[model samples]
Target: MSDGFECFKHVGLALDPIHVGTGGARLGRVDLSIVRDPVTKIPKIPGSSLAGVHRAYVAMAEKKYPGCAGQGQPDTSGAGGHCCDPKCPVCTVFGFAKGKDSTTGFTGLAAFSDVHIQLFPVATREGPLWVTSPEQLRIAGLSIPEDANADAVYRKSTSSQPLNLGWLLLPVKALSEHSCIRDELNKLGVPKHILDRFGVVPDRLFSHVVNSNLEVRTSVSINPETGAAEEGALFTYEALPRATLLFWEVTCKNPKHFKIGNKDIEAANNKDKVHSLVKKAYPYLEHLGIGGMGTRGMGRLRVLEPNASSNHSSEIEQSDKDKSQEARH
Candidate 1:
């Protein structure tokens, strides 16, 4: 809460993926990019991707926010290029650069971490399930029962067949209980009133197949002159599926003194302004979406904000109860 960039604020984020693409075209296997964890091979939302999208989205919403500096440069126009308003909200929050050396602009007051996957939605015979691993949960400062079953899948028959989780299939076996995952998540301050299907699966199964379940989309460009498909315009891409859960954190630092051009802005005021803007952006984000192909209905995310108040837990619990009742009927 103190200013001066001294404290790191961890803001938990839950992304309900509505088709988000962070990369396009791999050289060997995929035509377009499907960024994955190098070791686990599971799809991931990189920090760079989230940070770029966030900065762009914030800038676009405000009129005073500086536009592009150049074709491939952010500081192309030099010191004279930007509006350079000392009090400009966008300039102050996102940081601005100017002049040839560009040594003057204050580094951004906020830091964004890569949005890591907390849960992956999988289909099973019993119902919809949100699959995750104990290790994955632990990485986010959470702990799950070590002895809990990891390989849990639903099967229509006991014919020694594998379970099909969308594009990936595995041998049917005893699966972990959703209650175990739900309890741990609740303790970690997850809002139960939110998405109700989050569950836990074996880490091995999750890592092996979630990437294969990604949504692959094919696209082609049209030739304006003849109104025909362009000869070389066809391309294929992939995006995260709907209901994919992701997390990210933003740390706001209170600066001692920051410069917005020649004028000095107090550190406390700078921190306050950025935090305020973030709160305002929450509602707009659901409507606008983020990442690539937003116009095509990709990258719609909802953030669950945790309140420390006594009523917070009870409120979410009530919401969860209502959702369960509705589903029952």
Candidate 2:
């Protein structure tokens, strides 16, 4: 079990909508559909998608540190062998392709789980409000705010009523006074700046909030010669609006016994290195993004790290420790 994978590290991403697309046909409606949960129909960033993006970014950043003797450059051939070196951070985290791998047996040490919407943004009668479902909060290991309640029509806030977001109206059905959800969110590690605008609503209203709040976009393929829209090239798509807070977890399997040649890999060292590299690569998400439509400005995002505002001073200190460890190597 010592070498088995476990949730050694956790990371969150607050995806800012810039017109992300995941292409899906919807009978006669929009030309493409943003990825959504099958049951809830809420837009989501798949874990696989996030994992691939992180791996690529890590690879991109490693270009500078190209471990040992230039083992950092990506396998341009899509052929393996280029990153066969066991100590290479990129291949160590994202396993090498079959038939092209580290001579010392190792599976990708990182495990990425799908990101679920934590605080979904919606337009209401009162500016903007972030909504969370009982189920969702449970999944994220978060507690539902006391001010929120479930109702036939909405999970209305008794103390803080919603005003106007877009077209929907949140009818306040609760009458009891309660504290704002911000303090609770602050304790849970959501930044104050973001929590100030986000609030917890009932699960009953989540579907409406997300579906109605989707950012519908239009695009066209251009004719290079004419410099105009290609004939019948116009297409419409949906995207999860900006400022959507989605969270997922990543587990690093410190495979200490994993041997490269005759030496057992240093699981702690490798774990620390991979964690640091991933954190170092986060700033790139704001520029690159995930999902689809990079050229059209879709997919830029910000990965949330544990920090003081999120009330994780200890965790941040741990990251600082990791940096120190990384520097030594």
Candidate 3:
């Protein structure tokens, strides 16, 4: 097997508040809470959730749903929803387990990473501002000013007035004129309006600020028989607010060296093929949404195109041109 793999970073803009629940109510301010990183205490979407949805959407896109969308549990005849054919894009990109034996399963060619918040929107006196931190910028592969630290808020706006992030008021410090943070943000496809009001807060306060500004809504269950609210049915939940920017990475392994059921996969002979196949499902993620509570207007995320230079940059440009030409028709 070759040790060749390519990793691609993707940025997404939330169109609706996203809520990936923790399965049950927590004894906190809200009855229902979203999953959070244990160390940072910051909310994040698990890679497993992303993988499951991406697999299903890819199957649907390839017109192979119901067969290549499940766990591939065999039936009486030992066949399953997964075709287990090496040539199948769905099965090749996302591995399958069949034959009721561990030896028959194949690990998938692509792996997903957890989605992390890049720019969190917070309500402030200056209007709705996107809040980020030095640590957050570093994680997104952006450079911060040499003098920038986690002690004060930094922004390009010359306003000397203190800013209120949620209920916390913080004094603003003018960002360095040489800082390339804005340019980097632009390359990531952040809206110009959002960048105009961007504010960088101390890393120590980022978690608190984000949690304080999260969208919380109260819900109640109605009695099926009487058209009345059920007793003790009122509850509250939190979600990552709309317009939040998030980042995630996908790693595609070279598929030329892998085989399934003694047959090599011809569809994904190159790593780019595997990456492109997985990206084809991104449109589904944008339209159909991710996370939970989709029917109630939540979890819609729009994946932005990568504008940075990379090995596949030319291919991406060509693809965009083709899309534009198709739209003109």
Candidate 4:
């Protein structure tokens, strides 16, 4: 039988480029706003978001090195050559669109360890303003003139801050339980070494549910009483589960202030902090392969480390036998 449903949590993990300062952490705010139980107000980190961040990072890596990434490649059309049916091979197998010509199936944008590594490009006077200011103006259903001096309009609509390159540092508070990722390990029969090294938190669970599908019907008839036969069919589909989390961060820079020097200095400061945190979290990068094959791309799998720390360093250290095996190959 197939495995049952499972939920994962990030509990207590903090990813940084994290600023300890009052101003927004260089990496922004790490807010794990979703709790485990809504009634009890327990919070949990979402696995999907974690996966998404990893995928993004993968994509970023691919961009840095082209011809390095690709995804599952299956001939979508079936033997029958049917067109656009629900069970049609293309629609069912490939989903909506085909992937790019990259060699790797998985993009590196996922958050393997809830360690959020982000970059803030330098923002100029117009840069930060553009974040809030409209690139184009719109009034009612029609667009407003571009030359209409919309700066004032934007100011009236929302406050401004200098847009510049810098990282925001913040902490993410996520709760975990035994069931969250353990179930996956159980199915995969992960080795004891892997289980121990991965920092498996037994029974860490989160709240997530897929709702039932809604039903809708429609019928049409030509003449009121005279003519009358009608036929109908039922349409059914599953509703997937959706998850959400809140985020917040404090910053020293006033939203009202606009200083080039501050923006430049802050941008540089944040960038440095973010890179440092990323280096630290690099050690856990290999755990992303918890369930299946690790990182895959063009004829190669790059097992990497985020960085090192004395605290969890021993936890992720490799065995001599494993190292010798790796070296031999």
Candidate 5:
């Protein structure tokens, strides 16, 4: 069941932005790329990033609630009041939980929380450029804030916004696989109730391996023996890596099914789209701690519809023609 690809190496973040009008900005998109090492630069996406982002956001919300201190009750005296402190392993690697300490009343969370461990590196030009672009803003839903100025300040209060992780993780879901990770999870003594809630059945992981065909053309001789060949090429399709296919399926296809920890997630669910799942289950999602601050926070994910884009391009182009013709008539 192992693809021999055990360790997760590189993490990526791609983003897309939604512009309300030609002049006004509205939405964004984020995509992730994974790499085994810094050299080969071959990127394979991971699912943990997506899951981690959602989990981080949820934990953040829990800590931000009034009278709420942290995940689990910790001692009254600590650098950061949050259960998952800046010094805590979780906050350092994934995200930080910051709050007022009741005991000594210190401000910072030691060495851990202070450092923002970007799931994707910003050292490279491509990485840094992507982070600040409208695309990233769209993916992070930064363009659509609770209130322009006020929300920006509020976001500053926390290490990240509720949507930060989800936006960053969008690209990683493509390569999620169940190999040693699952085995390790079982070994960790995670209770069945918690595991089942993840909907991560070993067999079901197979569904994660969806298929995508890519067409590539290469030069070849039809009759090499005779040294005479046709100068034409044929179109052939091949299946992309299983992880790549799965990433598109969840993020680009049925995005509402995305998961956070053991819970169901739909960071992409658009509340305004009548046909969207987020709109359909708005009430339930809200009750289950899935509420967003503004209507824009309503789980609407703006992704690249490669297939749809190609198929409808001409149809849309012709529509413009039809409008012009009608005006003349």
Candidate 6:
């Protein structure tokens, strides 16, 4: 009962469109549909997907590829590919399973929450704007005035004219000068241009607006035999557009409380250590990208650091200082 669990919030900007597909074609507008939240109908990046990619990247970074990257294919001797070594950063932070496991598995120290859209970008007559909803703002720990009109759009701009969000247009109401939403977004390091064009729609319209404005493209498979587009091979898919902002949470458990196949984890002895090890793989994510259709120029996300007011900022700053001191030595 050390109360050693720590939660950290991560924000990311999509450098390219992201497509996390639903595996099979749906009987809808697009042949390949992206995964979506059933309740809200808003697309999201699943925690399982995040965990899998992070494990692969961490393994690649440590030069533990193929073995530590996935659920190890057991040999005739009944051994797995995972190192399952407590001291290995890849295995320790991500956990591992071997054989037909009952006693040979650990669920890992880091748990990821599904990534959700925070600010979705849309094209408007004025210019491109980032759209959000009251619920989305609340999830970011910001709130609009309780007495504010729910059916009207609120924006940081002084313009009182109507605004267009995708194909739908609504009359804009100026955000109260005292509203803290803008200030909070600034603290989160949102770009000035995006903040200036940000608009808040009612929660009811959020899903519609987001889905309507998704980036959809049509593509056809090429026939290897003829070196031409294959007949009846045309398909379309949708993705979360670039310049969109998203947020997710990671909960790190103290390594001292767990054991991996009779070995104690010493490299990541604490929650912060475990968290830092996972974050080290973020840069690889930025360059290598995540989700599906990466070869088609999608899924690049730039992870942003927490600001000074963030709950975990002090720990991150201290970690940076420690690294600096070590470098000087």
Q: Evaluate candidate 2 by giving its C-alpha RMSD to the native, one decimal.
A: 9.0
Taking the tens digit of each residue's C-alpha lDDT, what string does model 3 give over 221-265?
999999999999999999999999998888899987788767778
State which candidate has the highest lDDT: 3
Tens digit per residue, CA lDDT, model 2, 1-329: 24455453243444556443465557646788777788887777777777777877776777723331233333667442445456666666765543344334445677787777777777665556666666677666655555456542233244455455466655554422212334445555566445545544566677777777788888999899999999988888877777777777777766574655565554236565556755655777877787677776678777665543554434544665898899999
Error of 1 at 21 (Å): 5.2
Candidate 1, residues 177-265, lDDT tens digits: the string is: 34444554565456554335454456777776577666777778888999999999887777777766666667665544665556665
Residue 55 accuracy (lDDT) in model 5: 39
**Can you give the lDDT of residue 259 in candidate 2?**
52
- Candidate 5 wrong stretches, greater than 4 Å: 1-13, 16-41, 60-314, 323-329
Every model: Cα RMSD to truth: 5.2, 9.0, 6.5, 27.5, 25.3, 7.6
Per-residue error for 308 in candidate 6, Å, reads: 2.4
Write out the backbone clash pairs for model 6. Answer: none
Instruction: At residue 279, give the lDDT of candidate 5.
Output: 23
User: Which candidate, 2 or 5, would have the higher lDDT against the true structure?
Assistant: 2
TM-score ranking, best first: 3, 6, 2, 1, 5, 4
Q: What's the TM-score of every candidate structure? A: 0.72, 0.76, 0.88, 0.19, 0.21, 0.88
Please give the clash total of every predicted structure, in order. Answer: 14, 12, 1, 61, 28, 0
Residue 283, candidate 2: Cα error in Å is 1.6
Off by over 4 Å in 3: 1-3, 76-79, 100-102, 177-179, 308-329
Off by over 4 Å in 4: 1-12, 15-36, 64-329
TM-score of 6: 0.88
Error of 6 at 2 (Å): 8.1
Better candidate by lDDT, 1 or 3: 3
**Model 5, span 16-72: residue lDDT tens:** 111111122223221111122133222222333333333344334434422222343
Report the C-alpha lDDT of model 6 over 158-195, residue by residue, as the tens digit: 67788778789888877673236655665676754565
- Where is model 6 more than 4 Å wrong at Cα? 77-80, 99-102, 144-149, 177-179, 309-329
